[model samples]
Target: MQFFASLVRSVYAATILATTGYAPSFSGDTKHNAVGAAKAIESFHPESSFETFDVNGIDHPLSDRPEFSLEDAAVSFVQSRLNITSDAVAFRTGYANDVIQHAYIHQQINGITVANAVANVAFNKKNRVVSFGSSFVQPSSVPSNTPSISVTDAIAKAESQLAGEYNGHPTTLEFVAKEDGSVALAHVVQIQDDDQDMWVEAFVDAHTGDIVHLTDFGAHASASPVYRALPLREQNVTQGFRTIKNPQNKAASPIGWHNNGVTKTNNTSGNNVITYVRGKGGARYTTPQSSAPLIFNYMQDPTKNPNATRANVHAARVNAFYVVNTMHDIFYLYGFTERASNFQNTNFGKGGWGNDRVEVSVQDTRGKNNAFFYTPPDGQHGYMKVYLFNRSVPMRDGALENDLVVHETTHGITNRMTGGGTARCLQTLESKGLGEGWSDAVAEWTEWTNATITDWVFCPYLKRGGFRIYPYSTNSTTDPLKYSSLKTLTEEHRIGAVWGNILHNVYAALVSKHGFSATAKTDPKTKGGNTVFLHLLIDALALQPCNPTFPQARAAWIQADANRYGGANKCTLWKAFASRGLGIGAANRVDSKKVPAGC
Candidate 1:
């Protein structure tokens, strides 16, 4: 079956040989597995668009500076890589075909050998070629005798395991098989119920026709978690007990509280504004003590609360609320709560935490001190801003409310996972979103490893009303002022949502294939949370090229999946990500071994 990308090996010659351990054996009589032999031949075929300049013994020279423009360069590269001749006579008109199974035999002007090649070309609305499928091997490796599962069979099995029985729901099931004995099955299930639309995917063993894996992502499976109510004071007391920090006080105190050097409260009030600050002085240079926990200080407009006051007790009460949000709602926050006090006049930028303690700012923009500090000079100090775009007198509007707060905190947890060094903004953003999505997915998953959210309370932030949010809607396009001008909205959040959608689908696939235990493959830590999401994201990142695009992104993930987890694992996840226009596995055709290390 034709996949989503063209079959071309574009890599530096030296890198490819070294990475793939290519000895270039000229074993003429060597017999190989039918599938393996097909793969090897496809990997070796050279394109034919460029002029073949004979050098010493190497027939074609690998030039970093080729004599062609980028567009022509691409054509030349593909022709050379696929060994396609420019002459129409070489490309037999009689053999011209569309799917990957049809092979086109072509010969070059030089003495280069001609071979059969499959052409699966995709065209856009303008009829311009968008992508190509892999070259098909002559005498196709697909067994002529064995019966393969049809798209219908694959969909039925998936629907039974995933979709269940939905009344009058129009859906389409599509399947694609590759020479590697893996099949990708996709299902688009429309909804008549109140829930949003859902897309399901399943990977099947090409030979055995057994369902290998699956994923389901739709309005039903995409609901956020229900946050349990914990009083700020009680949350503080619970945290204090955990860290044994100032137990006499019901809430956990800020860092350095026992030393008395820690500033307990620093509250400043102006005409209509009251500022509460916490964690003014802590050992910014020394290693954190085992007992002292990382506390997340939250900045909120206290005017909304009925008992608004300038008392230290009010400051302390808000401190407990931050702790409660971290420990209960966000599970990644297992660290101790060192302290929670008020800042006098310092700006903490919206609200952020450093080391293990949270910070609150008195200034509007957090005094620039709480901004996104790039690799700081001192190894021990650094921070990122959580700017509140809009706010009401009583509450922070457009603020990263409970869900957004958890999402940012997840970034903190991930930073620790990769060590404290600076990470790519893309990496941080992608991983941050994944972490957020994971929290959301887990919340939804817990509700019913299978049921859709039935109440408005489950998805409070879906939209202006209690209605479900369109998981696939392009919302960033509508809100221009909300994001940065550096990149398009699609680049930032939409791209993010695409990644998020993939994760949701993949999680569903894993559950369908192996239940909850399959999550262990990626999350060996078994932290009651899925760490596989992290590994998959990391592996994909490692394989990604320096400058990546949608197509390359898809290819990178596939290459990583094939290399790290065996191509057979998470087949459904692969198919699902591909189907969403995120780019298919075939687009990521580079041999990752050649990729530079320590990215």
Candidate 2:
């Protein structure tokens, strides 16, 4: 069977690559030696070697001189002083106030860029280099450029190794450098595995017909049977049986339900998500399945029946699955491709690479009323745990709260998209705060799009008066928090509140100018100010640098708008940012609590 499969793949690859002229290189595994790179930088500047520096695993400090030119001097130092032979090409460079100038440089060998190898350098205002780092592949010896096997044969080998269905063709051909500095001429193929819900990049050795590297871009993930339920927001006064859309159904007419799945053990039929009920002891156990789809009946009165409480919990789980899947589809319409980090088990191979799924755990703790999202590194799946209602506190089940779920899920999205889909990149104090702000902003947008809530309040049940420090509104006076507020705030969530306020203002301004469209809510293709906001936000994530600060993030957003709309929304965006103290002149260091003053 294996031999037959290999033969079939070879035939298919041959047929596909016959018409293509040349293939571009794809990213492969590259081991970054930060310590070694730091040592190299230290060797050049012995005076600064003895001074202790705070290096973020990825960067090493050099000196604190304020007059250094990052573009000219730093690049020159890396090429002249370092042992790397590849030509360094500057791709990104920026400065923050009088603090530091940072640059990102890519290495190229034989006219082909080395995948995942980069040199990052930062210079202080005193003209001295303060930080330097590299994830560069310094090969000991150059290999023959000519390949022994054809590109088609390499693709065939890669196809034969795939465990699931995939689509798309080879995107590039280049020499891939391994962790040990060994290089090989390889065909880089882009594929989507729908069965596992992943976008994949497979690098096949052209000479050996072996898949030298496989990058799972990440598979980017539900339920029902009868269970009681509440309104999307548990605190809503309106109550009774309500029909909710079932996201799992592929057909035009999806399942409409009132109760959560009762008979489904794993909710496997939905295929988008798998919900597990781990009761008080954190042990997986079975819950009663209902035959009727009337799960909302359980939420009418919480004290009615023990079974009713279970049914209510189940209903929330079902709703969470639906909301998250809907969020996935909505973002997909706006360009969150399988390669961009979505939640699904299968794309079959049309979109990007899979295996990045969102795992939801309902009733996580015995009586803890809280919810959180955990994003693992790229290629790894993320899990969200929505704890049960606190028995002693005024809080209700977090799973029942759509806003909370959306907020947490947004965390996963931001973490995955920022810093090129790596969790290790967004670690600075400002970045952490930005992550929280993004979650809040996205959650608010989701609510507005659905027309489920008029005002943005994180959790109403948790705080009867509303949970957020300030409700998201069009009125600036309602939430006076601004970028300058970061100067006094140290906590991430608090700092995030300021950011959320700014976004809310932007959302309001756009709505006022473009007019909120109901059509956009249901149609992903429809363009509205709301859609524009989301598009720019997501695009900015791709453009943002690692460990970005407020100014850097603002620049990314502006760049995203330029890339997408040709700077159509520049005035409005600038005004919105300026209102929040993150205007053109806003500049602050990554570690500083002081906020940048707007122009």
Candidate 3:
């Protein structure tokens, strides 16, 4: 009865919108399918050179000849090959260089636009067409001008097709092309799960209520200790101390002794972060309001009694929040704005879409001995879950690990900034590995800034010294990740090692030239090598093209340096990249074993 009642309510709400008199329609008589489009492209010019690749089972023909205008070639090729109307495709986005001009075109049939059906056209420096690729649809026959069912009925049909508890809103009414080459008027509904963990856009046929298409937007995104510099204990804290006997050896493990000198409010909520106890029904737990600072018993098993583990975990949460907020603010100083895909709630309509919050889930997996970050699109909250380490050996809780927390938090930051605020852009093999590398670099930066530990290792407590393939050191023998190493490394983390090592060298070079200044950590204008490197790194992200390769990324850093210092650091930056086998003319083949020669 409740289910029916809820359905009735949803139907009523949806029906109310149909009363506004919005009806879907189609006007085009000619349709272009992939098969016809391919032929048309091949025959565009008999003298033009071309190549073909099978993308997602569709054979895409690309013209590499530089003899035609980009727009003219695209329009003429699609018109002659695909037979679509001239005005059907509209320009979406483009970027140009002396070597090539790339343009993205979107499809619009009648007046309504088709979602995700886009074509990419490229032109070379000679003003001639070079390449063309697209997933654009070619409809057989335009759908009827009118739909038999109302908008309310379409929404109900879409909801009916969903298996789990869901909430959705009708986003658009447009004609969508099916895989079978048929076109139909459909309702685009954005469906999100109750937990807000996953979301998808479903295209349901307005006339028959058949589900046509769906796009997934789900994005998925760490430590332990014995006594030495684990989690929040990376730095000594004199203000807040709570002593508890170690659970394994009954040795006293003092918690909450590592504070970064900045005082945080005892209230669970803050301007940018909110800390919650494990499994507290997502309720915010109150921090103890005392001058002596917050403390927890270290001997109690976090899984058995989360309350006993709260003081330390909470401290870790506070430290993580501080580190993330600091990184956010530091980047903000260098131009990472709300519109630039930053992680912050309540943007006040500044530059980015609002409602970006980072949810720090401490002790999330009980005794799972792992940690990870899950990033969603802008405006949606990002989730960081830190589990208690209990795999082969019962190690310290992950939340207490400073470098690990910073590492995981950087994942959220990088994912948001890259790909223009969507995690989808960094899905390439190299890009994905680079994301991990960026995280490690940032974690190392944070540790270096804090002057917490001398050894440049991650998760030192859990791994006795470090867990990475090599400690992030300047010594070439210790950190031997070359560009050629990517060929044998299929795992994301291992691939990341190559990138991380490269960045570590860059940091070392900068520090060696300009010298490290402790005050530069908070001040962007301090001119210290580390500060300059940080600023350059943040600026490079903004300058980086979508799904960038390592060479492109190297260029971005150089450009960032040029933009800030008028290319004063070009020689140093080039040396850093060249030393890592990412020098100019380095092949962008991650699957190749031959290493490029350094400059």
Candidate 4:
């Protein structure tokens, strides 16, 4: 979700497809009505900005707090903001400390759920609306429920768009809302062509039998061992093998890594992930490792011939298993939990869905120079393929590079969290670029051994420089990616470098003030700039709007800080972002190198 490649290249594709094919970002007649909240909001905080897409609350209590509950307030706010009058309802509530922190609502008209019409409202400890994102398109009118075409015809209409047969799945009737303010009653048909590795949701027009819209949900990793999984310092900066047993984090993998509770699995298969290898021979289900650990320490004297290490095939799988499971554990501690729709086969009866553990293919012979991750919705399996590179031994296995693993794995995180677990956001060119950037930033965030954060390139061992066009650095010359660079760069990863580098500076800015936390992973409350940045980063993913532009993302980070730390880091964040041209005035993918006064 690698050849379809960039989880997008299969992060930017070689041929950047026009993401305009997806539904346009939502806007409605309610834009004028939302300004009332803005005026109230500005009374408390002077710098707040409101749009049809997202609203950030000021630092003070919301004036329109509902008498009943946060859900009631959410419904009311969404109704006022999005102009959705027909039975606005809160379907999900996100809890933090025995209190509702956020409410998720869907727009329903005439008893039918408006496709992709959703909004999220967040509350602080004081039950105040801190921020919210809306893609809810409240139409001027609703179409008839009756379908002019049969379901069979709708399916055929969907299938006719491509050459492959429809992957066997059920079709449902729903309304497909467009940006032009027209709503079409359609059959949402899901088609998966395994051969093409293509899976998409096709909105077949029920009235006209024409395809109204299509969303490719497959939006589209590791290890260590003294038996030797590598570190974030890259493959060459090997920390060597360190023996570890039961490495799975207790809270993240409560049921252990190997067993899914329903069936006994001794192999690398587990509740969070399942690792396997596919040979070039095209054999099906040909390789899944056994539980028995092996000494994959064979380097085959890489100086002599790196490809000779191919004798130890299982070593890559072992490293991959370690890294994948470790990332699952580390990020879970940050915020990606079972309730947040994280990848896990079992949720221990917790919130969110299950049976969606990551499906990882190590050293997959599919492509070179890249690894990819394709994330479906919360309940479906995520697919990751790490291919082999030809340069530098350059017949290098991508699984050995921890950077690649982390980068690919994070695609799942950004995808699920961005659009409230829909995995349908981040499909636009800029959003997809953000997706690539977030993945790279997360990789850079985790792989640190000291407080002195260094400027580093990605997968330098495989590629001469890095998989990206530039090293994520604070140096303007080496990584001189400003917000303005985004306008010139159309490819996702290149565009990602700009965003990622900006975050790189942001991380540096935060770390300089609060210092670094060595125990970041083990301690949730580790109060350091690096740790704080991670909180802001992940939280911002949920805070941002669907198909977010650079400015929207920057605002989300500020709002996330407001919700998390009561705006303590607002000045620090503004300064960091401003230094990189994502200051108070950045918008529409333009670079603005200016911060607010007093920052």
lDDT values of the candidates?
0.31, 0.58, 0.59, 0.69
Residues forming the 10-long window of minimal summed lDDT in candidate 3: 37-46
For each of the candidates, give the backbone clash count: 35, 56, 16, 21
- lDDT, model 3, position 386: 75
Scored against the true structure, residue 489 in model 1 reaches a CA lDDT of 33
Count clashing residue pairs in model 4: 21
Tens digits of per-residue lDDT for model 1, 158-213? 44543343444454432333333322333333222222133433443334544433
RMSD of each: 29.2, 24.9, 23.8, 23.3
Alpha carbon lDDT at 271, candidate 2: 29
Off by over 4 Å in 1: 1-380, 386-393, 397-400, 410-420, 424-469, 472-491, 517-531, 538-548, 551-564, 583-599
Model 4, span 173-291: residue lDDT tens: 87766656567788988866653445777777798877666666554201111335564444432445444545667777875675654543455567888777764575423123332
TM-score of each: 0.33, 0.54, 0.52, 0.59
**Least lDDT summed over 10 consecutive residues: which range in candidate 2?**
40-49
lDDT of 2 by residue, 181-215 (tens): 46666777765544334456766676787665656
Candidate 4 accuracy as lDDT: 0.69
Q: Model 4: how far is 460 from its true place, Å?
A: 0.5
Better of 1 and 2 by lDDT: 2
